[model samples]
Target: MISAPLTRRAIFAQAWPIMLGQTTVPLVGLVDTAVIGRTGDATALAGVALGTVVINMIFWTFGFLRMGMTGMTAQAEGAGDAREVEAMLLRGVVAGVGLGVVLFALQIVLIPLALETMAGGGALDDAARGYVSARFLGAPASLAIFAINGWLFGRGRTRAALALQIVMNLVNIALNLLFVWHFHMGARGVGLGTACAEWISLAVGLAIAGRGVDWGRILSPALFGGGALRRLFAVNADIMIRTIALLSLFLWFTNAGARLGATALAANYVLMQFVSVSAFVLDGFAFTAESRVGQAIGAGSRSAMVRAIRLTGEFSLLAGIGFALLFFVLGPALIAFFASNPAVRAQAGAMLPFAAIIPAIGVPAWLLDGIFIGATRGRALRNAAILATALYIATDLLFRPFGESGIWWAFMASYLYRAVSLGAYLPGLLRTIEVAEPANGP
Candidate 1:
């Protein structure tokens, strides 16, 4: 799509930027925590944390805006459908902003219900409510930015995407410091900062993406064409359900750990950070696979699709192994850093081996997700995710008697199930590649 051949160099070129952008995402939260914690206001700190959790849960549900946009836009680009490419961006933006508006409208009801369920009635709930109110104001911008970034990734504009992420993170950090440290507005200040940064990023994203584009056709009747709208919604709906299923699995995992004891919960939380870090890094390759495979399919080249899978898989495997080794060698120190409490640190250390091996064990599942996402095989993804999650819950319940280690075992089993279930659909996905080889081709 970028007029460059797909090679390892090209793949890394696309991937590294995405990885860097993803890694920056956590920094925004870290800055919020640091600025709020320094005030010695434990209530404010906890409120911000709770608020963040709620916002992430809500926003993540709409992540289909990004994933769906990426697949559709990449296919359009691969097919050399320049008009459709532009239309896809407009459709994604409209959908994103529209969904954000719906979320904003529902905040009055959603906020109280979510906070009450998570924190119950207390000063904590009030504080979290304040934070959520401020942060939720930028819902329109935040969700719209997801579509913008997805469009950029679909077009293989990784550098542009990375640039936007860096800009947003920097803006967020700066505003957070000013609001929390200087203004001393507490948790609300943190939320306000993030919201302001999001609006700024939205403007910046539009400016970047709108350059050299024909807005006339993009805003035309074809943008709302019935068939296209149906396909877009169908894909988005499937991805959303698939995402929710995975979220449910992790929620269960966390809830199960909580039942074990406070120390176990803290240890599990710390251990999850290790998994998250590796996931963000390895996601680079997964994302690359999505774009490449989508392109190959769009062009109706099964050979190209095979090559994409092979190359992305190889890179993902290597990166996963590297992460596992790093986690194994530095397990104790990392645990100590995340968890200062002696009991939590020790509990996490005992289970560190499980976390260490997870990157390697999780590689296949992660890669398969990318492959399917790229192929835009939403039904296959949805089915696999649901089935795997059910199996995971059963395994978790069956191993409940083994204590914390059993939870880890169930977690590992979840990854295996995901990989296997997705692999089951991969053959059918390949069959959908409508190949048309040239008669004189060697």
Candidate 2:
């Protein structure tokens, strides 16, 4: 069994890398908004915002690559089965590539659908289309990078995952400046920069995997046969359902903001970036929980699993508190950084408190996600998420009389519900662990 002190240190060591990596996407978004805001074009900002909603929907749908792979690989690592570990990595890559291809094809038809659905026949429509089309070009590489990241994290190499993310975001940011500012490519430039960065990061991630892993075993055709593919698909499907439910809430919120007005939509968009920052940081702890819990489960150590849950949960709580305070102290400055229009900044500032409230209410659910995933209890997670999502939609609809503040309040309530409902299920989950354990075994 892993020692408690060693496990605690190792968990953080792994987590900080993921935390740093996760921080980059929002940073890039914040940068993009800041640069575009300087162009004095509200439409450009709106376009990026709308386009991101679409991209996030598409990309995040396949989050199973990271979630499923982490759990499965960690379990294999804990079980001391190198072959199974390699198989999990191989399966993730194949599935990621196939899914990417499907998403890319759909984008051809979907882009117009999204543009029309979001808003049709105007500058907003034009900008959104341009951004979506350009970003779609990188679908394959983007998906590949997800698989690579999952594989690395599964291997307990959070540092590698972190490095790849840093490289990808840094490159994307630099290219964004060159294309958007120097080349004057606007939304398309930003999209192209993101796509290019994904490809470059995938290349680097592949190199790292090759150096660190036993690819010969992983790539065997026997392991890539129908049974392996079917299992991976099953896991991914459950995760897809869970992710769809999760993302749909955000999508609906954005759509609702759009219905309000451009300024409200933009304000919501900017504030959501702050929420993303918290979510990403919290995800570090989630990743730690997944790896450690999966490892414990794989090794058939109930005590270790319990310890991991406690330690990771504590860490996540602390992180959430830190972010909440950070938002309270520096929120206005952060808002100013993203919005050049004094008016936009003022609007976003008004909403910053709502954003700050997310981590406090949402961190528990986030951490539980990793724990349940490590336990391979995807069905439970999918069900709980769907329930929470249903409540979110219901609450939002009920709060319609109160305007945006009401909507934000409902959003906060949704996170709280998710955390509580998921937490309530933990006791039963622990009982299952006890039942699964051999009477006298570790």
Question: Highest TM-score: which candidate?
Answer: 2
Candidate 1 residues 317-393, lDDT tens each? 99999999999999887665545567767888999999999999999999999888888888888999999999999
lDDT of each: 0.82, 0.81
The global Cα lDDT (0 to 1) of model 1 is 0.82
Q: After aligning candidate 2 to the native by TM-score, how far in Å is the CA of 21 from where it should be? A: 2.0
Candidate 2 lDDT by residue in tens digits, 26-107? 8898888888877867778888888999888778888888888887788888778888877776677767778788988898
Q: Candidate 2 overall Cα lDDT vs. reference?
A: 0.81
Q: lDDT at 247 for candidate 1? A: 75
Which segments of candidate 2 are over 4 A away from where they belong? Answer: 1-7, 119-121, 434-442
Cα displacement (Å) at residue 427, model 1: 1.0
Question: Predicted candidate 1: what Cα RMSD to the true structure?
Answer: 2.9
